[model samples]
Target: MTLYEVTGREMYLKQAADLANLCATWVVSFPYLLPPETPLARLGANLTGAVWASTQNKHGAPGFCTQSGDALFKLFRTTGRAEYAELLRDVIHAHAEGIQPNGKITERLTYCDADSRGSRGDGGKTGWNETNGALMALEIPGIYIRTDRSGMFVFDHVEASIVRQDRRKMVLKITNPTRFDATVTILAEDARKAARPLGENAHLHWKEKVMVKAGQSIFHTIQK
Candidate 1:
């Protein structure tokens, strides 16, 4: 399960996008505007404003998270807004058709609606463990990845092999794509159920303040 499955905050990213737009816009005229979260706002109001505009047409007018959900995640985390979290989950799910084992989130990236009745194909299924899919790589103890963190793996294409050695010891092996090589940090607390209810052991990967190495494989061991 991805981050959306755990909290469903992304479900409301659209709404958050709308709100963030208003918030960011309203603050633009300020003598000294508060800096927004990274990759976007951290870039400045102009960049954040561009993100808002992109959110409006993300995946061409709603139903996408790569742009909006990311924006909302930053907003919600910064402002502690519930609406941002809700829209965050929705926007993420909008693009992500469904979550698969190994953190492969099959995304339409250009869907018409939630049920994915009429959707456009933009090759969202390329299987990239960037942002939304990296949720599966940290399924082991002491493993976690923060998608928005600079210099970290994307979390969409990373696949992890969770091996239980003896009783309390576990080994997590991660495979990444060659496109980007950032050190992704995967953390875990305990095994829990998934948000969307998947057949293959859908477990949530814990996250921490770390990053993933690009195209490189790494392992971490946890002892109970």
Candidate 2:
């Protein structure tokens, strides 16, 4: 997508979309029912969006090893495909499940027979997992809404609602329940805006950032 934006080449966009679909194959589409005694099961963790490492490793993890996977979001915006958005949403939410109160996480969110299966692993504070999670939060919008279709999609751990709406504006109430502070991204678009071609760094223009302290709520109003 960036390549397309930079070079105005149709080939680049097609290649990026194809690559995003290929990456989707590695993501677990269904939640596995783990052994009742497993730590993940006891904690009610869902592995729906966990990405498998490889055929040999046979283990699934919260997000990408070292990248945010924001390319999927860019593809969604460019193609107007809900599947791309939904795939990233699942991964983002799954990443939250393994996070500790202090924002630490282990890469092992597995369902395979590996030694670390259904466990967070003893690898304590896997920096890659933390990096991916933070990158997703920073790059992806917490909530996206399309005014023309009355569509809303959430991709963060925070709670959100459309508290007020009229012809001129829409108001949102977002709450953060985690131990750490959150910077929620809100992206809203009308039909004309949504139909426009996305350029490099287009998200920065459409997204609004709201800072919510832990266990607090804030109201954001967006003009139509």
Candidate 3:
């Protein structure tokens, strides 16, 4: 499973065009591989329904989990499939609905309405570990998004936008998506000059790191 996550995330990090094509094929073939016998077939139908529904085309549950969402995000990043991202976001929000004030999430999730209440064994605990793993490589809007044409590579979870992306410079509108202050290490390249981090104290150089406060968005720019 770890390898699957890594490969999915790497598809974005490396921005390999071939890998993007491969990921698209994988998603297309996923439905056919399910067996018609047993409960697995029903679960497969639910998942496909949820994916299709998320796109407003009309649509799964207990199959909803942080790990599953993470995989979907990777697929979205790899293939630029809006549906994949939508489904994953839907799952994340639904899973969040079941979270307790103490931060533990219930084990099962219903794909219909983001409900997080159920007892599917494991004593109602299932999200902490997978959530951490998912967010560690969460994809956000930026120039580094995989494409047939190449520009840059990005790997990290930060709610931000790319204000500019030219050959000489790359400017990012960055925000810390987490509740607490964080030091985000954006695995990137083309950093030879100083970084302009508006209202933030961190510098973003080539392959360097930056820091941001909880709920604060900063304009971070670096020259090549």
User: Which of the numbered candidates is closest to the native, going by highest TM-score?
Assistant: 2
Off by over 4 Å in 1: 1-155, 191-211
Q: State how far residue 51 of model 3 sits from its true place (Å).
A: 9.3
List the lowest-lDDT window of 10 residues for candidate 2: 198-207
Candidate 3 per-residue C-alpha lDDT over 103-127 given as tens digits, one digit per residue, 9 for 90 to 100: 5544333332233212212345655
Q: State the C-alpha lDDT per candidate.
A: 0.37, 0.82, 0.41
Q: Please give the ranking of all candidate structures by lDDT, highest first, separated by commas.
A: 2, 3, 1
Candidate order by decreasing TM-score: 2, 3, 1
Better of 1 and 2 by TM-score: 2
Q: What is the lDDT of residue 136 in candidate 2?
A: 84
Quote each prediction's TM-score: 0.30, 0.83, 0.43
The lDDT of model 3 is 0.41
Candidate 3 TM-score, true structure as reference = 0.43
Q: Which tens-of-lDDT digit does each residue in 1-224 have in candidate 2?
A: 77876777889989998898898889989878899898889888888899888758768888998877888887887778899998998898888778765658988887898676788664478789989887886677788888766677788878888898888888888889978798777888887886565554555674578899999998989777
Candidate 2, residue 98: Cα displacement in angstroms equals: 2.0
lDDT of 2 at 198: 59
Question: In candidate 1, how many Å is residue 212 off?
Answer: 3.9
CA RMSD, predictions in order: 17.0, 2.8, 11.6
